[model samples]
Structures are given as C-alpha cells and as structure tokens.
Target: MFLTIIVCGMVVALSAIRANCHQNPSVCLQAACPESWIGFQRKCFYFSDDTKNWTSSQRFCDSQDAALAQVESFQELNFLLRYKGPSDHWIGLSREQGQPWKWINGTEWTRQFPILGAGEYAYLNDKGASSARYYTERKWICSKPDTYVQMVQQSPN
Candidate 1:
C-alpha cells in the first residue's frame, strides 16, 4: 500500500513539472526589449531612429539577430500596425529591380492583405494612395530572438 502511494505522488509531481516547462516558445519572458524594438511572433523588430534606405533597414534587423518580417496574413499585418508609432518604417518585402513583387524570405505569395500594383511591392504608412502604384512606409514586425532552452528542475517538497 505504501509503495503505491509513493508512486502516485511521484507521478503527480512529475506532471506538474512538465506542465511548467511546456511553455509557449513564442511568448517573451522579458517585458522590455533589450533593444529599442518590440517582440512579436517570437522575434524582436525595430523601427529605426533614423530614416534608413531599404538596404540599411534589412541590415539593422540582421545585426539584431532577426530577419525582416514577412507579411503573410492580415492578422500578422494588423499585429504590426498596433505597435506602430507616428513615423513610418520599412518591412521586409520589396519589388525586384525588374519590378516583380517578392517576399524577402523567398516564399511564394500565399496571402496578400493589400495587393499592390505590378511595380508596387514595398509598403508605406498612409492608407490612401495618390496612385495605385505607390504606398507610404508603415510599421514592421519581426520574429522572436534565438536563445538556448534549458530546463531547471525544482524540488516540490
């Protein structure tokens, strides 16, 4: 009888430990960003303090250990929009030199929130367009930071 009780207690303790460890990887542990950026989709994205060209903004994301955000859905697009400040910023998508729109991740377009004109790929802040071909710069989203996961066991008793 005593042996059965010990085993049952062990099972309950193990279950609790497992539950705590199985946390969502995308959820950030820290409240404030280590940099000026914010966390989204398990990555940190920054709006530049200075207005940088498309190339420079990409470099900034790279230096911070995150790729530029690829907009795949309206939910993802809206997630970025909520965090946007007054000034517009660049995201990862752009038109090829020949004017073909493509995601920086190289994935074929699966979903598009606001499809642009043939020559239009990059996004801008302002909702209204003077022409169908151009858009104002808008807010950007990024993936979570990469970190090693280590499980620390705690004593329940």
Candidate 2:
C-alpha cells in the first residue's frame, strides 16, 4: 500500500513538472516562451514554415491563439528582416477594399517603413516590406504576448 501511494505521488509530481515545462520552456525567467517561439522584449513571435495567403495566414495565427506579427518598433522590424532569410513572409498589413492599409490590430498605416510593391496585402522580403495581392501565398509570422511575464511584473512586490 505504501509503495502504491509513493508511485502515485511520483506520477502526480512528474505530470506537474511536464506541464510547466511544456507550457513555457524557460520557467526560471518570468515569461518563458514555448518551444519554436522567439521571445523578444515582452512579446513572443513565431515564424511559420507553411505558405498561405494573407487572409489564410491570419486565420492560421488566430487558430494558434495569436495574430500576425505587428511591427511596433524598429528593433522588432530589424529582427524580422534579419531572421526571415530568403523567402518572403506575410505580415499583418492589408487594405480594406477601397479603404487605406492598416495593421491587423486596426492601426492606420503610418508608413513607418516604405512599402515597395502595390497590392492589398503586405509581406516582408530581403529588400523590406512590400504589398501584393491578397491571394499571394507566403509563409507568415505570428505574435502573442508572453503569457506569464506581465502578471509577475504587475503583481505586488
């Protein structure tokens, strides 16, 4: 009976440890990002290998509980430009038919970076961000908030 109890307790502990590590790979830090995600500043960014059109890419990100990455800072933009390699990847910018271009988060396009091609959807390549048809298929980057980092930082010290 004692051996059985010990085995059950060990199983529970092991499960808990697996859950923690699986959820966040770097638990020693406040906001550890999951596997395959890049943790930068307070955000987690994921670059996908599969190709999809602008709309499909956003839907894919939504399914992953994230959004197409929004470039808020020059540093973030540079990181993307440098790491994206050769293939062009769809970003979160698109026009609403007759309306002007905007980020996926609903911010107006302020032209922080020059867009090269002409189209309804924007993507990133070695030359920089460009716009192309919405149907143009490409890999994509997704962004989400680091799950636990902010909570610990905001909690009462």
Candidate 3:
C-alpha cells in the first residue's frame, strides 16, 4: 500500500512539472528579427523615421525582406495607428490614379477603412485617414512574417 502511494505521488509530481513547463507554449517559441523591429502576433514590423517617397520606401522594405505595411484587418490597422505619430506614413496600398488599388504583395484591396483619395500611392495620416499622393515623402512601416524557428523535442518511444 505504501509503495502504491509513493508511485502515484511521483507520477503526479512529474505531470505537474510537465504542465508548468508548457503553461505557455509560446514561451518556448523564438523569433528572429533585426534590431529595432517590433514583434506582434506572428509578424515583425519596422516603422521608419526617415521620410521617403512611396516607391523608395517600398524598395527599402524589399531590401529588408519585408514590404510596406499591409492593413489586412481592422486589428492590424489599429495596431499601425497606435504606433503612428503626428505625421503621415506610407502603406502598401497603391495604384494608378483611377485604377483599382492593390497591396504590394499583389493582393486586391478589400478593406473599407482606408478610403484613399485619387493618387498613385496611399498613406495613413495622423487622423487614421488613408489618402493618396504618390510624390509626397512620408515615413513608412514595413512588415514581414515572423522568422521564428521552433525547436521540436523528440519523445522517446
């Protein structure tokens, strides 16, 4: 009877330890990004302080393995807005004036929040309004998927 109790206690202790170790599986996940890049959800974002035209900004982001920020959802748009200051920032929405807008990744623009004005490139102003002015120099935000590589533990069979 005493041996049975001892074995059960050891089993419970080991289970508790395992549960604690995996309380937050994300705690074991690691993401790699350049210095100064911000991590949110499963992505990395970089907000540039230097002003540049939309085309140039896109080039810079491409060099960094990212693209101009694409507001895929309201939550993402709000996240970008929260980081925005008093100045306008270039986003990934752009097209020939009077043409259907599209993201840098070639995705069609589907969101309705950023009602862009008649211009070739779109930007988000301090008021969270999205408008277009291709030649205007503005700060920019770049986003890319998280570079996290999960380390898998092998379980003994």
User: What TM-score fits each model?
Assistant: 0.56, 0.74, 0.72
Q: Which has the greatest TM-score? A: 2
Write one digit per residue (lDDT tens) for candidate 2, span 2-89. 2211231232333444456567655545435768988887688889899999899999999978899888878989999988889999
Candidate 1 residues 1-157, lDDT tens each? 2121133224234444344446643333534355566665544556556655566666667777666667655765776666655555566666655654666777655546565445444643545111122244334434444331112123232
Question: To one decimal, what is the Cα RMSD in angstroms of model 3 from the true structure?
Answer: 10.2
The predicted structure with the larger lDDT, 1 or 3, is: 3
Is candidate 1 or 2 superior in TM-score? 2
Ranking by TM-score: 2, 3, 1
Clashing residue pairs in candidate 3 (N, C-alpha, C atoms within 3 angstroms):
none
**Poorest 10 consecutive residues of model 2 by lDDT?**
1-10
Clashing pairs in 1: 42-143, 42-144, 43-143, 43-144, 124-136, 124-137, 125-136, 125-137
RMSD of 1: 9.7
The TM-score measured for candidate 3 stands at 0.72
Q: Positional deviation of 122 in candidate 3, in angstroms?
A: 1.0
Error of 1 at 64 (Å): 1.2
Clashes of 1: 8
Top candidate on lDDT is: 2
* Candidate 1 wrong stretches, greater than 4 Å: 1-33, 97-99, 117-121, 128-157
